[model samples]
Target: MTTLAEGKAPVHLWVVGVLSLLWNGFGCYDYLMTELRNEAYMAQVPPQALAIFDAFPVWAIALWAIGVWLSMLGVILLLLRNRQATTAFLIAVVAVLASFFYQATTDLPQAMGGASYWIMPAVIIAVTIGQWMYANRMAAAGVLR
Candidate 1:
C-alpha cells in the first residue's frame, strides 16, 4: 500500500515518466540528425522532405529546437519529481504549436503535403499536450515536488 503522505511516488509516475522519456528521446534524436544533416540518416529521408526542411526559416528552426529540447528536458524533470516539469512542458507545447503554425502557412512540396506528413505532427502535438497535462496533474497531486 502507498499513500501521498508517505512521499513515495506511485508506480504510474515511473511508468509515465519512462515512457515520456523514450518518446521525447526520439524527438531529440530526430532533431539532432536533421540539424546535423547526418549522411546515413538523411539518406533514408525522402528528397522532397529534405528540401522542405532545408527551406525552414531560422525562426522556425529555432522553435523546432526549443520544442524538441525542452520537451526532453521536461521529461527528465518529470522523472526527477520536479514541479518545474509542468512549466517546461508548457513552453514546449507553445514552441511546437508555433513551429507547426509556420509550417502550415508555408507552401510545402506536393509530396510532403500528404496525410502521412500531417499525422506525425498531429501525434507530436497531442503527446506534447498530454505530457504537459500529466505533469500538471502530478504536481497538483503532490506526486511531483
Candidate 2:
C-alpha cells in the first residue's frame, strides 16, 4: 500500500540524521581531544568567544559531550532500522537550532564575515530539518511500520 515517495522518506531522513550526528559528534571530539584543544587554537579565537565558553562550568561541558555522543548513538540506532532514533534526533535538532539562533543573532552580525565559514552550519541545519520532516512524514504514512 505504500507509495514510492513514502518509502524513500525514512531512508533519506536516516542518512541525513546520521550525517548530523557525525558533524556535531566530531566537533565535540575535536574540542575535547585534538590540536584544537591546544593554546594555539584558543589564542586565535576572539576573547569574547573564549569568555563565552569559559562562562559555562566544566560540568556543563561534560554534559554537552555526553549529549553529543548520545545523539551519535541515536543516529546509529536509527540507521540500524530503529525508528526511535527520531526522538533522539529531535533532541539533537533542538540543541543545534538553539546554537544556530544564538550564533546568528550574536556572533554573525558582529563578525567581518571572513571566509564565510558559517555556511557549513547553515547547510547542516537545512539538511537536519529536511531529514526530520521527511522522517516524520514517512512515519506518519506507516513507512516505518
Candidate 3:
C-alpha cells in the first residue's frame, strides 16, 4: 500500500524507464551506424550471443535496429494508455518478460553489456504495477466511477 503522495511507482520503475530510453537510443545508434552487424566487432561477442541474431539471418539485424524505435513508439502509446491501460500494460508486461528472457539468454552470461535493457524494463514494470494498483484502489473508492 503506497501513500497517495508517495507515488504508486517505486524507484525501480523510473530507473527501468530511464534505462529503456538509453538502451533504445544505443540500439538506434548501432543500427544507424551499421555497427551492430560489423563482423569484426560481432566476433568479439560471446559465440552464444552472436548466434541468437545469426539464427534470424537478415531479420535479426533489422529487428535489433528497430527495437529502439519500437520502444519509443511504445512509450508514446503508453501515455495514451490511460484511456487504454490494458493495452499499455500488456505491451509493458511483454517488454518486462522479454527483458528477463534476454537476460537469461544473453545478458547475464558475461558482463551484462547493456545497461539500457536492465533499466528500461524495470521502470516499465514498476510503473505499470503502481498505476494499475492505484487505478484499482481509486475505482474501489468510487473515484474512477
- Overall lDDT per candidate, in order of appearance: 0.93, 0.58, 0.47
**Count of residue pairs whose backbone atoms collide, per candidate:** 0, 0, 5
Off by over 4 Å in 1: 1-6
lDDT of 1 at 138: 91
The deviation in Å at residue 30 for candidate 3 is 5.1
Q: Is candidate 2 or candidate 3 better by lDDT?
A: 2
Q: For residues 1-145, what per-residue lDDT tens digits would candidate 1 score against the true structure?
A: 7546347888999999999999999999999999999999999999988888988989999999999999999999998899899999999999999999999888988888878889999999999999999999998998887
Across 20-47, the per-residue lDDT of candidate 2 in tens digits comes to 6677567666556532457766767777
Q: Estimate each model's TM-score.
A: 0.95, 0.56, 0.36
User: How displaced is residue 100 in candidate 3, in Å?
Assistant: 5.0
Off by over 4 Å in 2: 1-25, 31-49, 55-67, 107-117, 137-145
In terms of lDDT, model 2 sits at 0.58
Which stretches of candidate 3 lie above 4 Å from their native place?
A: 1-20, 27-36, 39-44, 56-69, 78-89, 95-145
Question: How good is model 1 by TM-score?
Answer: 0.95
Question: Under the 3 Å rule for N, CA and C atoms, how many clashes does model 3 have?
Answer: 5
Candidate 1 vs candidate 3: which has greater TM-score?
A: 1
Error of 2 at 69 (Å): 3.9
The top-ranked prediction according to lDDT is 1
